[model samples]
Target: MKQIIKIIGNPKIFVYTLIWLMVLVVLGTLAQRDIGLYASQQKYFSANITWLGNIIPAPGGRITMVVILVNLTFMVLFKHNLWKIKKIGVLIMHIGGLLLLIGGGLTAIFSSEGNMVIEEGAQSNYVDDYHNMELAVINTSNEALDEYTVFDQPILGKGNILSHENLNFNIEIMSYLKNCEPLKRTAPAGIQYRGMLKNFMLSELKPEKENSRNRPGITYRITNSGSSIDGIYGIFFGQSVSQTAVINNQNYEFIIRKKRTYLPFAIELLDFKKVLHAGTGIAKSYSSEVNLIENGIPRRVLIEMNEPLRHKGYTFFQASFIEGLEGETTVLAAVKNYGRLFPYISSIIMSIGLLLHLLSSLPKLLRKIPGVSPS
Candidate 1:
C-alpha cells in the first residue's frame, strides 16, 4: 500500500497523466470529423474505455481523469509536508483543483440537457434528448393521464430479455439498429408476426453526422402476452403511430423515440419573433415569448439567444427556429446542471490560494534584498 501511494502521488506521475490527457483530447477532436461530435464524445471521452475502430481498447477521457484525481487525492492524504503552515497556500491550491475535478465528475454524471421544440400557440412539458433513444411503453387506458414505463438505451441490446412487474409479458429484443427505416411490404406477414412488422420491414441505415437526425428502430418478440397479440413487433422513431397492445385488459402503446424527459413545468410559445440582418435574409436576433406554467399558474418570460430563463434549476435558452406552413417554431435548449456553480467557486478558491501564496512568500524575498530585517 505504501509503495502504491509513493508511485501514485509522485509529481512525475502527475506530469505524465497531463500528457496522456492531452493525447486523448487530440484523439477525440480528430475522431469528431468522422463520427460527429456527440458520438466521438461518447466513445472516446465519456466512456471508461474507448475501442479503436471498434477493436483495440484503450483508457478513455473519463478513466484518465479518474487517474489524475486519484493521484491528487493520494498527494493530499499521504504527504505530510503539505500540512505545514508554510505550505498552506499550496495546499489550498491543490484543494481547489481537487474540488474542480470533483465538480466535473458530478456534471458528467448528473447533468441533463435536451431540446424542447414548441410550435406557436402550443404547450409542451417534455424535452427530447439530442442523442439518446428509449423504448417507451405507455399505458393509455386513462383518458386524463397516461403512465409511462421507459426502457432506456443501455438495456435495449439485442437478445436481451426485458420484463417488469408492471408488464404482463416479456419482451425479447431481436434486432436493435442505431439508425433505420421502415419499408412497406407487399405480402402479408405470417401468424407469428404482429404490429408494424405485419405491414413493413425495417431497413438498416447509416447514422447521420448530426446525432439528432438518426432514426433508430427495434424489432422484438412478445412472450407470455396471454392473447393472440403475443408475437413479433417493430417500432421506429417518428412513426406517427405506436404499436398497440392489450395487456391485462389495459391498452398499451410501444414506441421508440428520442428519450423524453417530462418537465415539472410546461412551456407555451406565445410568440416567436426574429429580426433579419441588414441587406440579408439571415436572422440577426430571434426570441420566444413563452408562458412557463407551473401547477396551473402561468408566468410569462422572454427567452433570447443571449438571454435565458432560469426557474427551479432548469434553464431555457432560445436555440433556433424552424419555419413551417402553420408558422414559426421555437426550439428551446433546456439544461439542468448540478455543478453549474462549481467553476465559479473553484476559481474563487484558486484566486484566494494565489493571493495567500503571494503574502506568504513576499516577506522571505524582501529579507534577501538590501537592508530588510530577517526578524
Candidate 2:
C-alpha cells in the first residue's frame, strides 16, 4: 500500500496528469471543427445553446472533470509548502488565475442573469430579461407588498405549480423549447380562447407541437372571484402590452416577463456619458451613471467597459452600448454569483507558491556566481 501511495503522490504523476488534461482540452476544442464557418464574415450562432453546441456537445467534452482533478492534485501535492517566496507580484498573479477558474466554476453552477426593460418613465419590480435559465415569481396584487406566485421549471416537460393566495390560478409547464420559433394554436373548448401569445408568454394550456410556435412566451388562464380572464401575452425586446382582462373585481394579468425571485434587488440606469478621442472619430470610452436602489436607499453608480459596479452580492458589468433618443444610453448587464470569494482564496495560494518557487531558485543562482562572496 505504501508503494501505491507513493505512486499516487508523486510529482511526476501530477505532471503526467496535467499533460493528459491539456491533450483532452485541445481535442475537445478541436472536435467542434467548423473553422470555415467560424472564420466567415457573417455569423449566425447567437443563442447560447447553439454556441455551446458548436464548441462542445451536450456531454460537454468531459474536460471539466480533468480540470477539477488536476487542480485537486496540485493542491494536495503542495499543502503547506507554498509560503516561502520572493516575487510577490508573480505569486499573486498565479494564484489569481486559479481563483479565477474556481470563480468560473461557481458561476457556471449558481449564477443568475436576466434583463429588465422599462419605458422612459415606467418602473419595473422585476428583471424581465434573461441570458440563461431562471426561476420567476409573478406578483399580482397592487399593494405595497404583493403576494408572489413562483415558477421554477428549468426545462419544460411535466411540471405543476402551486397557486398563491394573490393569484387566481396555478400554472402547469407542459413543454419548453429553446431557439426555434413556436407555432400558435387554438385553445380547447370550454376554455375561453385568448389572443395569440408570442416570444415570451405563459400559456394556460399546452400547444400542439412544442417548437411549432416560434413564440417565446406563455399563456395561462385564471378566474379570480368569478370573472374569467384568459389571454395570450407576448414578450419581446421592444415595448409591448398584454391584453387586459377583468377577472373578478380585481384584474389578473401578466404585466412583465422577468426572473425576479432570485434577484436581491434592482438597478436603474439614470444617465450615461460617452467619451471619444479628439481629432479621430473613434470612440475612446463610455460610462453609465445608474441609480442602485437597494433596501429603499438610492446610490449613484458609474459603470465603465472594464470597470464593474459591485453591490449586494451581485456584479453589474458594462455589457454593451445603446444609442437611442434619450441621448445614447449604456446597457449594463447584472450578474449574481454566489462563489465570488473562491477567486480571492485561490489567488492568494497561487501567488505564495510562485514567490516561494522564485525565491528558492534565486539563492542557488546567486551562490553559483563566479566572484560572489558568501556575505
Over 4 Å off, model 2: 1-24, 27-104, 113-129, 133-147, 158-168, 180-194, 197-215, 218-250, 255-258, 261-268, 276-283, 294-297, 326-328, 337-351, 361-375
Query: Cα-based RMSD of the predictions, in order?
Result: 2.7, 7.8
Cα lDDT of model 1 by residue, 111-220, tens digit: 99999999999999998988789998988999999998889999999999999877888999999998999898888888888877888999999988778788899999
Q: Each candidate's lDDT (Cα)?
A: 0.90, 0.50
Give the TM-score (vs. native) of candidate 2: 0.59
> Model 2: how far is 98 from its true place, Å?
7.2
Provide backbone clash counts, one per model. Answer: 0, 30
Give the winner by lDDT.
1
Assess every candidate by TM-score: 0.90, 0.59
Query: Which candidate number has the best TM-score?
Result: 1
Poorest stretch of ten by lDDT in candidate 1: 366-375
What digit string (tens of lDDT, one per residue) describes model 2 on residues 127-209? Answer: 53452333334445476665444454353234434356655555444334333233444544333445445322343333223
